[model samples]
Target: MQQTEEHHSYARATWQVVEPYHGAVYFSPEAHARYEELGADNRAGYFASRGAALGPASAELVIGTFYNFNPDLVHRALPAAWQAASPQRFLAARLAGIDATLHRVLGPEIGSAEMLRAAELAQQAARTALRHPQGRPLFAAHAALPWPDEPHLVLWHAQSLLREFRGDGHVAALLAAGLDGIEALVTHAATGAIAAEALRTSRGWSPEQWTQAVQRLCERGWLEQGPDLALTPYGRERRQAIERTTDELADLPYAVLGQASCAELRRLARPFSLALARELLPWAVDRLAAVAD
Candidate 1:
């Protein structure tokens, strides 16, 4: 139990440092500039640049994992973007986007240097961590990809890969325990990151679809019936178990870092994450708070 808790703490801290990059990339001017150069708009550019790193994967591959954007949104973006530019071109655009965003947000200073150093430490740790069992398809594919030469880019890509590694594992764990995508999302909504209504709207699930999911969970004794939509005791236990499993799966990389090294990575990365929250992208902070909750 204690080991699990320790792993959870390290995983949470690591995520805090890197999570901003995942969301802020969509909002950054640098990312926009790179997208424009690629002859794609923000939505298509985002879908292409990020998806390109995975190779010319199908929309089903993308929608099932990686992105939380509605399936319709992704379908509209892909092949169109691919037709406009090859995956290699988009991959280059993706790196350029990250570079521009980080530079614009962090600027040239000790701050940028520290973030790069943190990325190096994280990449080293993740390299050690990925030696463990990973069952998720997306993570497996990403883990086999080449590492970037630049420390900052290495950090972003490393962290991104690690995040996906854990996410893919979590999805596997969720499925093993019998929660489908909508059920998983509904359970997550119980955490209050975004309202239930917002989750339904954002994911483009119809009201009937959302209601049916809730009913299915209720039938399984995971959630209570009717308007309130609260989790039963079983529901809470199941949710916690899924989270615990995910943390355990995510632990090896941090374990390779050891307690002291994990602490140092957190120390180095925390201020930069905080600066990102305060100076440039408060939405990242808000999202972090939701995830932490």
Candidate 2:
């Protein structure tokens, strides 16, 4: 692998380990309790609390990269929370939610200190890399937000910020290459996770909508014609290019950490990630393996 590929690989490994923990909020009891305290009742309420912290950003902005959620749900959820609180209040609530969820999931022991240390290292790297002006609007906004006091929470928020940073950049890359939200999902379906049917259900896209997106890609010569669509050479190359660009953009932070430090961070984070995966995420091990492949 090339140097950039190596850097991207390690960065992805680090992300995979921490990502499940961040996502645990969706299922965690403590997270729901925090949301209830914040006057939120359902999943939409939780999404609104966190999404509002990204500023008075439009639902279009959130829906673009948050591709899996139904747009109508996001539209409905955002205004209620956004209208009720100032950005500062929303951010505070968001942090509280993260703290509650992580504490419950990770507990007091099980390498919490090591996780904090690794998070600090990763945050430092992300901060150093973010000095440059970039098109990562969501990331830029969150990066400017204040940090939490507790080390574990700090790590969770920092990792959240970095993930948004990378995600925003990836969206930019996708658009530049002429792939829209559904189209991108169509391409992604060609590789991992199953087919367009799975994406349609998971992402709340209707069959007609998915077909339309696939048709668009077909017109562009990126996808082969027919019901069982696959990526043509052009499609494969375009997807690869998008991925490479995203990796390059996201690489700066990991590059700042360098090889040895990056490896060490992964080592420190692995056990926590594994434990969480076993307890919380049934598909996480398979997801990690797919990334490695």
Question: Which candidate should be chosen as best, given lDDT against the real structure?
Answer: 1
Give the whole-model CA lDDT for all candidates, comma-separated. 0.73, 0.70
Prediction 2 TM-score vs. true: 0.86
Q: What 10-residue stretch in candidate 2 is worst by lDDT?
A: 284-293
Off by over 4 Å in 2: 1-3, 36-43, 64-70, 84-89, 110-112, 289-293
Model 2, position 230, has a per-residue lDDT of 90
Off by over 4 Å in 1: 1-3, 67-70, 110-113, 132-134, 279-293
Q: After superposition, how far is residue 124 of candidate 1 from its true place, in Å?
A: 1.3
Query: What are the RMSDs of all candidates, in order?
Result: 3.2, 3.1
Evaluate residue 272 in candidate 1 and report its C-alpha lDDT on the 0 to 100 scale: 57
lDDT of 2 by residue, 90-193 (tens): 56666676676566667874346797687778678667656853777767777777776777766667677778778877888888897777788899887555
